[model samples]
Target: MPPIDTSIKEHLNALLDRGKGAGAAKAPAASPVSTALQRDGASVDFENVIAEMLGAIQDMETQLSSVLEINTLLETDLNQAKERIRELRQEREKLLSTIARLEEEMPSKRELQMVIDQLIEERSDAEITIRDLRRRDEQVGAVLKGLQDAQRALEDSRAQLQSELAAVEVRLEAALKDCGKLETRNRALEEKNAANAAAIKELEADLRMALDERFRLSIELDETRRALAAMQGR
Candidate 1:
């Protein structure tokens, strides 16, 4: 037995011995007076002796009852101790199983942590690339806007030039029509001048003929007058 159990047993035995000693000490004490009363054939004063015997019996009974009560309490305590030991052993086994499981999973937990870190790094790099692409897209949009503005300006210039060209074409057409009218008028005037020149030449020839006739008549008149004067003188 364990030392504690041995000690408890020793204590119980001591209690039993103490109870026995108390009982033995309280045994009936016989008196010589009572024995003489019995031998003289007279009635012994038995009341005092009887009272002493009854007291001794009651004392012994009290001691025995005390010992029995102590034994019962010790047994109850021992049973409770045994139940506590059994529960402690079960709890120890459960703790050992949990520790073993944790040990088995340590390497996998480390690997998972490494994978998470790598994924985080990759995500950071991707975010940087996305930012760069957005900047480039903004630059391209600015360039496209500039090109659209230039195209609009060029179209406006072309429209203005076309309007001016249409006005110039209308003016040229009108000038060409006026030139044709002037040419026709000049040709008609040239023909009329030629006809007037022919008419003037015919009138000059008739006037010269008439002047020759007048000159002949005047010479005849002068001859007649000279003949008459010769006659009168004869």
Candidate 2:
């Protein structure tokens, strides 16, 4: 690209020299329109120089716009790079935190072995207990069956005893009725015996009076016979 300052300076110096030359030379002054229309060499040179300066300015403006566009692109790239670096740093910190946490949480080999051994021992003990309990449960089931059979036997015996007791109670009730009848009969016999005793006493007293009367009669008859024999002898 051409330099803007140099081009402008050269054009201005040429213009100034033309003005000085025109002023120094004694020439008839022409009207502005005539001189412009004449298209003189100096006028034509000045117009061409102005046209070149304007073209140079336009070229400079285009180059300046391109430089600005490139600068803007570079700034965008730099900002993007800075943001990516920041994200990477954050990711690094997170990874370091994760590593530290894992290190703290991880168990030692000895501790893991101890836990495995304890689990094995517990499993063995549980198996032994399960076998013992199963055997005991079988024995208990057998005993329960025996108890149930004995209870059934006891129930049958109780039913038989109740039947026998019912029979004995019936016999006892009949015996009680017979005893009641005997007591009544015995009371009647006692009353009859009492009446017979009173009659016997009265008959004994009558027999004694009859015997006394007979004795008196016999004595009287003997006395009468003795008197009669004495009279005859006389």
Q: Choose the strongest candidate by TM-score.
A: 1
Per-residue lDDT tens digits for candidate 2, residues 1-234, read: 223345545745565577578668996545453465466532333434444544554554465555455556555655655555555455555555654554455545576567556655555555657886566556555655665565566556556555655555565555455555545554554454444444444433443343354346445534644564566569
Candidate topping lDDT = 2
Consecutive 10-residue window with the lowest summed lDDT within model 1: 1-10
Give per-model TM-scores. Answer: 0.35, 0.32
* CA lDDT scores, all candidates in order: 0.49, 0.52
- For model 2, the superposed segments whose C-alpha errors exceed 4 Å read 1-3, 6-57, 108-110, 125-128, 131-234
lDDT of each residue in 202-223, candidate 1, tens digit only: 4334433433543454455346
Which segments of candidate 1 are over 4 A away from where they belong? 1-128, 213-234
What does the lDDT come to for candidate 2?
0.52
Q: What is the C-alpha RMSD of each candidate to the true structure, in Å?
A: 92.6, 88.9
